[model samples]
Target: MPWGEIKDTAAERRMFQRRTLVMLGVAVLLLGVLIGRMYQLQVTEHDTYRTLSDKNRVQVQSVPPTRGLIYDRNGVLLAENRPVFSVTLVPERVAGMDATLEKLQQLLSISEEDLDRFRRRLREPRRPYQELPLRYDLTEGEIARLAVHRHELPGVEVAAELVRYYPHGELTAHALGYVGRINRQELQRIDPVNYAGSNYIGKTGIEAFYEEVLHGKVGYQHVETNARGRTLRVLERQNPVPGEDLQLHLDIRLQQLAHELLDGRRGAIVAIDPNTGGLLALASVPGFDANLFVTGIGVQAYRELRDSHDKPLFNRALGGQYPPASTVKPMMAIAALDSGVIGRHETIWDPGYFQLTKGGHRYRDWKRGGHGWVDLIKAVAESCDTYFYDVAVRMGVDVIHEYLDQFGFGRNDALDVRGARSGLLPSPDWKRGAHSQPWYPGDTVNMGIGQGFMLATPLQLATATAVIANDGVWRQPRLLKDVVGDTPLDEVLPKATRDNVILKNPDDWNFVTKSMIEVMHGRRGSARRASVGASYTMAGKSGTAQVFSLGQDEEYNAEEIEERLRDHALFVGFAPVVDPQIVVSVIIENGGGGSSAAAPVVRALFDAWLEGFADEETGAELAAAGSAGESSG
Candidate 1:
């Protein structure tokens, strides 16, 4: 204490005062800096920070537009959309996808198919924050379970969407097709921005043809979300534009009738309006329930359809390529008459078979014993193979090819009919390019009878028959009737794209039509039995296509051959000879004889079209279709 007290008292006081002043100065400098920073944050950058805060709570979402509805000519619902609840997940909002999926599985049932579809889609290109469906058409119990655990799982929601539903799935499966979930390949092909929030797309038939018109414009909305990524409210929204409705020429009653007529048979039926090329009915038997593919078909179920011996998926009306058989006789008659290969009263001698020369391969006729002497009308009515064989040789393959092409053979020119095959209309050039061989005389003879190298689809046959009914007018077949949109039906329908079959003699059409009528009502008409109860004039040609060729002298014995190896029965016809109400083509696979099998089928369909279905019968039939559900799965 004595040593410390030695310091000067004045010096100690001065030092304390200096230190206090220095501390005060430093404090004032720090206060100045803090004031500057406060000014910068509160005034200069206020908008930036406010925007950042809003972004954390708000989100922009895409709203998918409603798809179009499809109806038949009679206003029957062919394809419609039914509301379905689905479980969906937003990946970005999820804390941990693996953990969330595991938790979801524990709460409800999830099929391996749904999981596979989800996992596969997750790898595909998609818009930001898109919701992926985990399960579709959830059961009430599953929905309850999901609802109870909704708060436990983040980024999970139950969504309702209109899914494609076909009331008469089996009846219109091939004609109307069905929608399916978008896949990775489709993602690359479709417009990402436009298709945003849309799950399904048309896969085939008219659905695919009019997809652009059916899929309406997308919309947008700004929504406010909570801290937990749950949507609180919509801040702003643009209402989505619903797709336009479509009306088709397809008659639901006719479609059902066609399916019924083809029941228990493997075949196809194509009916069309001759005046306008609208299809009344297009049916392929052993059809599947298109709904199976809408959400997702089960693995086993798909395998069964793919491996079934019946080939239910095959579009026989548009795709089955068989020899046109004697169904082409009328067309050949026109070719022969117009080309001067034969006259209207052309005569030929038949002795049960045709010979190219004095001694050549004898092509046996359907009638083992022959029609003896026959004129053009009698030949066409009796389907005399000898008469056609002679004219085909004179006309040559090129002439035959040219005439057949004019009738829409060897190519698919229908404006809206999809999945049709361009059947072979063999010519010398085609033979050379395809088989690297010259067209043989026998090949030409076979073409005359719609065999050897000539093949056509049931649709093609129907169209050709329609040309006759329309009096040489060429109108491409179409399924679309009218669109309920800004665009009118005429604007939507393509203009005439083909030429009418003109002849040197305009009366040739009348002559050929008369000959075709003879094939139905003439005393020796092949299809006379089918025309027995007809109240109106009818014209038809029955045809039988051999599944296997016979030897020169081999006789056809239906009982001796396997049923599957029997001839394919075919018939093409149009009724009310004057106005020609409807044109139909029927093909039955392995159905023994044309007159016995296909002719009756055509007769029934024609009667339905002309006479119209009874109201009571239609109700009962529709009820049956609804009950059947068209779903084997």
Candidate 2:
């Protein structure tokens, strides 16, 4: 007062001092807390914070391995990989998926299919931050457009990848198969870690069968990325291992020749190396382009293929089932001889037909006037149905089933042949099971000629013929020849399923083989005309399988029947009788006669293989073998 006159000086001084001290103490405490917090963040939690920071700037990305190249035995490339650019997006990185996809569509002109496929993939479970493809095979214009808009669109990327290519296109379609986009089903089956970045998977044929060997190991890389998720640089990389290259036993030249031989017809041709059981050529006419399937085939293109009457998508070589017809006669003869039902020299009198009783229903022979008194060799050469019918009734169905089963009928158990159908071999048990009917004597007669309930795939026919060529040594038919790397084929692939067809008399093989040769060289041989002027010896059997049974008094006239209802002409043979090199099976659908339509085609194959493709020494050696075999016989 008066300024301090009326004030209590001591008390005011003490309170002032206390307040200052209290304020100072509080300040010191706050500062200490700040310092402690700073130390905790910058020292104790340093590693954790630093790791979190680095995660925002860096990423570990999967690198897909290059798919293996598939080549023919002659080093002709069948399947390869070509580089392509595609558009992709990572869902987690996008702010608004619907808006981003809309903007992408506007910028890239994306189709409804692409949108649908993208949405479908979005619904599937995937690794966090993994990029999903929206469009494939982007053009330069589209890439440029996307690049200009990339900054505005988060998670969008233009990635370059390798897609599968088939050089031969439609020619090797069924044989080599094709790769396709990994669908939902495939995604479930595939190893997620191994196929993290893979988009394509084998869909069929060799591609499907060897998918594991063809799809190599996955690799990873540490990548530095900008805020917009654009990869600035690769920080560290672990290169992926490429898949094992495959060298198949398929010969492109032989394959092309077979295609040419079966041109303009619905048929299949199967050629095998008798010595190795390797498939040289497997041709199914009217094949489609395999390349279309590599990058997700269009709806229209796939529908066309799926609906076509020609069945271009079908693998006729491995799947087409037809009666082996007289082509099975040689095997039947072996069966008869081994079972002691008939001798090599046993004769049966044919009066144009066979009868179970003296006045029973007649099973007419193809030849109107009968082959007269015919032995086993004559019966096989002339294709005398009556002889086989007589023996079939005598031997019964049980014996026939047992013998044919030994020859690989009623089963498609080859190690490398995928999706091959087992043809039916009828027996008492089978007839009872399948049709609820007992096996009849007439059924046995029909089985004798490879008819009635008997059905055989072209592959089985070729394999059986190959077994015959190998002198009853059964080696499983295979397409894989070698793995083009340090690994041996045996280590990489499953061992071939094999067995020997034991015969009572081993010489019986020689007898059947010799008789088959006569069918090509004899005076009255059914297929003799097909062998005119041949330098090499070819043992063959021709057969005609009826599409529909004829009336007892009616003869088969091709002009009267519909084209599709005509007989299926068939022929099976091996060249160089003494040392068989190739065994061929041909089936011409709806062809009138086997001798005329199918046998000539087989002869042409023989000429192309033995003369056109064979070396001079090979021809000479085969010629000498033929001469020696003829003279001895």
Candidate 3:
């Protein structure tokens, strides 16, 4: 056989050509697939991948607005903001949260409470990469320490924010209140959009009442960051709107005087402008420093305040429910006169006591020797319990209840005052509802003396006295005098409804005013000594509320009882009687006599306000009164 014929050269060439064609076709398919995938990645899904990459380099942040400033009527700063440095952590960026927190604790003096609060916030639902505050108000040393160790930390940051500060410290604590770190409850209620970066919220008093107006709109910023999430530069920013400034009706001078007068005593004083219903001063002695509560108060510090006998944290001016005592005599006198139970010239005889029936229980008078024969004016001037007791019996309980109600005895409709208590005014129905007891004639006698279940707050007393000073025009008491912002005060706050307390005879107001005047200026007046050096004409009533009842034959000797068990001295007054300006109510807890303790305090306030802080025209009148010494005469 020939080798060329056996090899089949022609068929071998055809097989090689077929193999080459198949390999070239497979190569072409793979090239085409690679081109398609490259096109898809670079063109079709470009926006999606670019966005994902940019997220690692750029970040959007919420910019918190600055909180509002609080000022007194004279523009003295009450509450302001100060820059504070805080340590924060982003949980998602943190490599080992437990280890990081442990390191932070060692580096800075992180309290267990701080760590606990931090852990709570860390567990809460929040936006990814949001910084959570761990320790606030960092000292310079702590901040430097954190900076030194920044390279080793991944998510830890030293951030700066504005924190609330009270310049006056304990002086304006009760009135202005304080702002604190936002808590779980507040977070649930606050606007997430507006408060996105806000960490603090108002907790009480005016701060709490005007929270919305003080917390302005939030803003935003875009920043570029590196691999470690450190902000390199701001890409974009929207300036935040600062909160509105507040101007309170509080007179710092008068407020300071009230505190000085009440120093070393457990007491409260409230003063109001009769014409405007603006709060002039609200003072509760033994006040605690409000700044402590702003940045999270210590357990030990808070415990001391909570347990202290002085009750420094307690707001006594609007919350203290005390017996008004003879301070309400003028109001009761109005009731008596309006009911026709007594006339201006009505006289009552006292043998040191009065009985509802012959041989019944004798309601003893404050003066053991009795006031002798007393007319309506004399009774009011001397605070004769016997005269009130007789009129109370004759007018009955229902009439007394109706008349006193018109004077705001049992209610507080003051719009700006957030937590004023509605004092208890007892009636036949109230007695039955509260104690399941029937009304008795003796109860009316006790009510006439502002005793036995009649409770009133210092604010209520001031407001009622203001009504008298305004000549029966009932203006609800208020703390807010004006708003210094875009928002109208009425639109921002609830409207305070006004009404007139019209007496059957308008002369009744004049009659009561004159009687009150005599109480301060009359020779035999109970508060005559207190009025001796006053410049302007002041009308007032002094009272001693018994802390405990005396036996039928027992006499009250203040020296015999414990100081806390002694009577509470009280006084309510309005100055420049004809055209009254300020009305004041004061209570000295456990003080022996209203005339000696409370009246002196009132007189001092009246002098400070009328002589020291009054307008130019009013000051002239006060100067004339001081020179003439008509009050002394």
Candidate 1 structure lDDT? 0.85
Q: For residues 363-435, could you state the per-residue lDDT of candidate 1 as single tens digits?
A: 8777778779888888888788888888889999889889999999999978987798999888888889999
- Shift in Å, residue 341, candidate 1: 1.1
- Model 3 lDDT, residue 139, Cα: 94
Error of 3 at 413 (Å): 1.6
Q: lDDT by residue for model 2 over 336-418, one digit each (tens)?
A: 99999988898999989988888988888888778899999898888889999988888899899889998999989566767
| True-structure lDDT of candidate 3 | 0.85
Query: How far is each candidate from the true structure, as Cα RMSD in Å?
Result: 4.8, 4.4, 4.1
Give per-residue lDDT, candidate 2, residue 236. Answer: 97
* Model 2 ranges off by over 4 Å: 1-5, 8-17, 613-633
For model 3, name the residue pairs that clash: none
Question: How well does candidate 2 score on lDDT at residue 48?
Answer: 92
Query: Runs in model 1 with CA error above 4 Å?
Result: 1-42, 615-633
Runs with alpha carbons beyond 4 Å of true place in candidate 3: 1-42, 123-130, 613-633
